[model samples]
Target: MSFQEISPADTAESLRNGNAVLIDVREPHEYGAERIHGALLYPMSTFDPRALPIDSSRDVILHCGSAKRSGMALMRCAEAGVPINKHLAGGIMLWKREGLPTIKVDPATGRVFDPQQG
Candidate 1:
């Protein structure tokens, strides 16, 4: 794999320290439902490596419901000659499993809540 995988703990730390930014590769509905607090949405259905907001200041990490889509996104980046090579290993499922925080929106109330609280 040309890409490197980052664990939820490490990803969280990186984000907390402002050393990295997350890119969500899931669809719009999935992103609207729940996601890492600061993750920027860029659905795989319309993902374009050329249009990614990569910069030299911070590393960009990609993620989806699972690592599959993010892995595919990495491949796309590689094919397009984009150098982004990190993803949240095992995705949000693992992130939640690791007890990390996520922003969840209630479909009925449109209210956001902490999954750990509900």
Candidate 2:
């Protein structure tokens, strides 16, 4: 089943307020290249329910490069009794498309950079 979506504005607000947990379901390599400032890494192939710091009662947002993987993860998380809270409506790409903040992690020296600059 498709999961509920939270708007970019709402997501940004929740994130700024430290009330939202952003779960990124992208590959480790891909994530190392670039991602949001603070997102939880949870590879779809190896999602451990117990590893999550989220409680089903709280706000937990999931995402992928686009929206496909996150959608799948959301269904699986719900099926596995992880949580039923809010998730990214259209993934990070959408969030970026909406001009949201995204951080690029340097693979060479492991440094983080702001995407807005370059």
Candidate 3:
């Protein structure tokens, strides 16, 4: 099944308005290195569409390093009868390119900092 793509800017707007839940489908290590500030980790390696916290209150948007994994997850959701069908286009790469806020761990300090600020 086809899925709808939400741009990083628009995704940020929805998140600011509390209208969307961002789910990162990348692996744990990948997420630990850097990620969207409020994105929740739900690695596609162990993804279970049925387990997703889906509700009418918020739109669940999936994303990954480049959108490949999220698209795959969306297809999995479709097969499992889950209604989540939106994702962040171009994934975190594009989000970063667009100068959005991201929480990144500084290897030397192991502290989280906004990459956009650097």
Tens-place lDDT per residue, model 1, 17-101, is 9999999999999999998988999999999999888889999999998899999999999999999999999999999999999
Off by over 4 Å in 3: 115-118
Q: Give the TM-score of candidate 2.
A: 0.82
Question: How does each model score on TM-score?
Answer: 0.94, 0.82, 0.93
lDDT of 3 by residue, 1-118 (tens): 6799999999999999999999999999999999998899999889999999897999999999899999999999999999999999999999989988888888788988875557
Candidates 1 and 3 compared: the better one by lDDT is 1
Between candidates 2 and 3, the one scoring higher on TM-score is 3
Itemize residue pairs with steric clashes in candidate 2.
Answer: none
Ranking, lDDT, top scorer first? 1, 3, 2
Please identify which of the two predictions, 1 or 2, would achieve the higher TM-score against the true structure.
Answer: 1
Most lDDT-accurate candidate: 1
